[model samples]
Structure formats: C-alpha cells, structure tokens
Target: MFAPRVALASLSGESDADWAKACEHPAGAAFLGGVALDEPTREAARAMVDRDRDEFLPEDPVEFVDDQLSALDDAFLRAGVNVRTVDLDPLREVTEVCASHDAVLEVNAHCRQDEMCAAGAGESLLRDTARLCEQVETASDAGAAISVKVRAELPDVHLPTLAQAVERAGADAIHVDAMDSRRVVRDVSDATDLFVVANNGVRTREDVFEYLSYGADAVSVGRPSRDPEKVRAVYAAVKEWFL
Candidate 1:
C-alpha cells in the first residue's frame, strides 16, 4: 500500500527450505535472484535458496522466468506472496504464465550483465525504444501493469526523457537500477508522475534515504549479503513512509 513497492529480482534455488529463508523477509515481496540456466543444479542453486545469495535457475531467458514462477508456486503460498519474473520475450511466454499464477509481471531493463543483454532482455530494451514500447504495450494490453525496470543511462543518454517514455507507453512504474554511481545513477525526483522505484547498488538504510529524498514511491533490493535484516527493513520502511 506504499506509494512504491519493494521487490527482489532474480531469486532461485532447488530447495523449498532455501526459499523459505528468503520469504522470511516481509519486504522481499517479489523474488527473482537466481543462478545461470546452464547451472540450475541443487549444488549451484543452493546459494539462492539456502544462503540467500543472488542465483538464477539455469534456463533459457523465457524459460528462466517460467521456471522461477513455477518454483515459487511450488515453493510458497500465493496469498502470502505476489510472485513475478524477468526474461527476454517475456511477452511471448512468461507473462501468460504469470497471469495463470496470479503473479505480477516485470520487465527487467536494468540487468547490464553481458549474458543477459545478448539474450535481448533487460537493458537492451532501452537501446531500442520501439521494442520497449512494444513490450510495454504487449504486457499492458494483457491486463497487467507493466513495470519497466531500467538502470540509469550511460553519461550520454537523456534520463528524464527515457523515464517519461516508459510511462507514456503505459508502464505503471519505472525501476531505476542505481548501481553504477559513476555511470547509471538516477535522481528519484527526475521521474515525474511515474512511480519511481529505486534498485541495485543499494544495501543500507541510508541508501534508501536517497530514494525517498528524490520522491521515489518505493525501492527494491537484493543485497541480503550486506545485511540479512535489509530486506525486512526496506519493506517496513516503504509502508511506513508511504502507506
């Protein structure tokens, strides 16, 4: 009910117990952290389900989103969690799958990972506004609130224009990954009208203040390593600040 929501991206694992630990944090409403598809074995996924480390289920881009949603349904109760996924061509497959599970759908334009970009998801969408609008319209038309997850642009791009276009294209929210302070950093105030959700390169209570100061409706995070308490704290903070 906060102005913005806090969610975790790319969560994965082979064990329900591993997933239970992450669910323990109330702020982690949506979990997406996972290991590479080429390595979804229990041994590799243990970091995600057990240690709460960032891991993805080894899967093709679209399949990865499906796999995560499937695992979430099998791993947790629907009433307790609003699950979701991120992948390439999610409009082609993953979104339908999410609707079936009554899960939320997210388009990750923030992943700067080389392997992910090559797959044609994440930040690559930013490079092609035409495709970006297509993806947003596709998901939005499906009765889903398309969340455009993007990182701060390279020093050369127009940040405000990019943020505005996402909203103009029917995106319900804008996810700004502020991991590279030197490169991709967003001032929450820059996003007008759009629900600006801060993400990435964030691991502390103070880091969250940066978002609120800039008028971010909410913030998302995955740095469980920085502090096991961080996820819970963020969730509580968003509700406290906005709701």
Candidate 2:
C-alpha cells in the first residue's frame, strides 16, 4: 500500500536500518532483516554463515528489531522485517515490536537455504501450508499488518492456493518471489485479494513493467537493491507507468 509501489526486498545479512535508509527515497516500502528469531533458526543461520552465506543472528532478536525500526523513526516509507523461525511463540513478541513501529512483520516462507528448511523455516513452510498460515495468523493477531514472503515454482506447491489460505489467515499482503515461473504472479494475483508484490530478476524499468503487466500491485528489487541507479530506474519506471 505504498505510493510508487516498489519495494526493496530483504537481503539475508545485509538488510538493516542503514541499508533501508540508503535506499528509502525512491522506493515505497523497504523490508528489513530476514532475521532468525528462535534458537533453531538462529543456529541454522550460523550454519549458513559457516558456508560464507550472510545472515542476521542478533543475540536478542526482538530487541534487534526494535532498534532497527527505532533507527528509522524519520523515514517516510513503510518499513518491515522479514523474519524466520521454527516456533510460533517468538512471532507474537517480534510482531508486537513491529506494530509499535507501525511496520509490517513479513513471515519468511520464501527462503530456500537447506539449513533454514531443515530448521522447519523458509521454503519448508511452503510444503506445510497449515504451518505457514498459523505463522501468519500468529503475527496478525499480534496487531501487525503482516505480510508473507513466498516463492513460486517449488515442487507440489500451488502458490495461488497458498495465497488463498494465507489471506484467510489474516495476512494483509503476499510478497511473491516469482522465480522463473513469472506467470505464478498472475495466478496468485487472480486467486486472492491480498496486495501482491512480485520479486525476482527485477533490474530494469522493463522488468518493473513486466511484473506490473502480470497483475502485480507492486514489484520488488532484490539483488540490485544496493545499486542505487538500478533501484532508482525501477522506481522511476513505476512512477512513470502509474502516473
């Protein structure tokens, strides 16, 4: 529900308050850390780091979220956090912090890391729709405008159906990583009323237009988010097209 309708998707270890501030201008929404909340998820994050993968493993995750949002007190764009955890208990507290900051708590069902899946987080949630919806409902009940980050093209996972289940579970938005199967954006868009934010390979204005044409309410820039020029170009594309 942002003006230009472009979002900065969360990067594993890189996305934080400073990162959000740096890229906040042109984009309408910026999602912060894919922070690992519970112990299992945090331990998996450590394993990822051992493999040279980036991750956010703060000692006090709920407090970390508070500090991150507090640092962005003056930012004009909406801010959110993409969180991962195996247990549902932590979401309530973390989401409360998100609500206090007027931010969205994005449940991460999109991550594909083997470690994350083994911890029963990330893409594993895709295979377990019930658990994913429960996570959504947990955050939603905590007074958060919750969003669920989901990826398409996973085996046996019908995104449209998953989208419907989440919508029924009180999610406000669906951040779809339309990996390879771009039409999944349209399918999910067609199936539900959730605000759809399409992601993946979004580098140019044309890419922005492509996702918009597929019925995406907004398009997110992932890898090139650090490239201000590219993010600006995509933002300009959305502004120009929407205007």
Candidate 3:
C-alpha cells in the first residue's frame, strides 16, 4: 500500500530504474517492468520486438531485476516489479530478489499481446485462474509481498472469482487494469480483501477520483506516467480525497 496512492504502471520496454525515477516525484509506488523472466517469455518478447514492439529481454533476467531494484536503493517510495514467465522457476528466482529488496513482486496477467498469451503468460493467465493463483502463492512462499496484475473484461474470465482465488493463494494486492470497465474494480474489491490498485486511462484528478469511488485502494498512471503534471494531478487528488 502507498501513501498518496499513485503508482507508476509498467510500460512495456521502457520501464526501468531511470523511468521509475523520472515518474516518482508524486507517486507512492512504482511497478517497473513487465520483464520477461524465462526462455519462453523471452522468446515471445523477442518476437514482439520483431514486430516493432518493446519489451525487456535481458540476457540474465533475474540478475537484471536485482540490478534494477538496487538502483532504487535510496528511493523514498515503494518499489515493485511486474514479471512475465511461463515457468515457475524463473518467477521464483525473481521473487527472491524482490523479497531481498523489500519490493513487491507483481505477477503479470494483464498484457494482451498475442505473443505473451501464446507463451501461457499475460492475459492467458486470466483464462487459467488456477495457474495465476499458483504464481501468487509461489511468489508469497519466496518471502515476497505478492501483487497480481490482472486485466478486466476478458472473455469467459470472471474477475471477481479470480480475485477471491488470488486472495486465498496469499496475494497481498491485486492490480486491476480495468479496460473501459472501471466498475470491475469495485467487483474485485468487493469480492476479496486484496488491496486493489486500479489502472488504465489515469491522467487527471477526475480519473483518480473515479477509480477510487469505484473501490480502488490506489490508482496507477500508465501512458501518462512520464508527464509530471498528470502524475502530480493524481497525487494531489489522492491527498485531497484522503484528507
């Protein structure tokens, strides 16, 4: 949970320590990376790059995570890493680094890329809630605070049901990327006690207020995160609302 309740969401290839730093002025937490953690996911990321997309494809994924987090050693705000992997082993490896750094390990189930879904990660996890819950439990067992980043409005995927299962699996938070269905935040929040961080289209104070009104514990800035004025606006909205 963050102070002013504004988090900087992970942007495909650009989210790193420097990106986080640039957006951290008024954010309580920064969820960096949607980093590819295993060979399968890395392969998918590479394929995405082939199509002119961006992704974090480090040679040594876990080590890269450790280094990125270490760069935030003196940061005043909380740090979190959103990770992608089809294998549990790599996820466990990254979770250890997150735990050591006292950072939240966010399991990425929000990405809608065809490449990611084919790799059995990203939005594919939404279709397999059981696998997603297992990831949350795996991260928690590694001594990391767990947050599952999920997308809304996926076909045949009941978010409220998924949220309850994730909570039971030991996730401390659920980051909801509510794609045009902001009310989904309320559904997830009402379904489970997991801290809900609502995301998508967050820019102004009104945007922040709308998500909070729908039961989000926090709201995150995605595309507009690099804009100081937009991030500051959400920060001010949080401060004012909580006052």
Q: lDDT of all the models against the reference?
A: 0.54, 0.92, 0.90
RMSD of each: 6.3, 0.8, 0.9
Pairs with backbone N, CA or C atoms under 3 Å apart (clashes), candidate 2:
none
Candidate 3 residue-wise lDDT at 203: 75
Indicate which candidate wins on lDDT.
2
Candidate 3's C-alpha runs over 4 A off are none
Residues 2-24 of candidate 3: C-alpha lDDT, one tens digit per residue: 66689999999988999888867
Error of 1 at 209 (Å): 2.0
lDDT of 2 by residue, 1-243 (tens): 665698999998999999988878888889999999999999999999999998898889999999999998789789999999888889999999999989999999989999999999999999999999999999999998999999988789989999999999999999999989998999999999999999999887788888899899999988888987888899899988788
Q: What is the C-alpha lDDT profile of model 1 across 1-75, one tens digit per residue?
A: 222266554433332224434643454345343323222222334433454544444436455555556666653
Backbone clashes in candidate 2 total: 0
| Better candidate by lDDT, 1 or 3 | 3
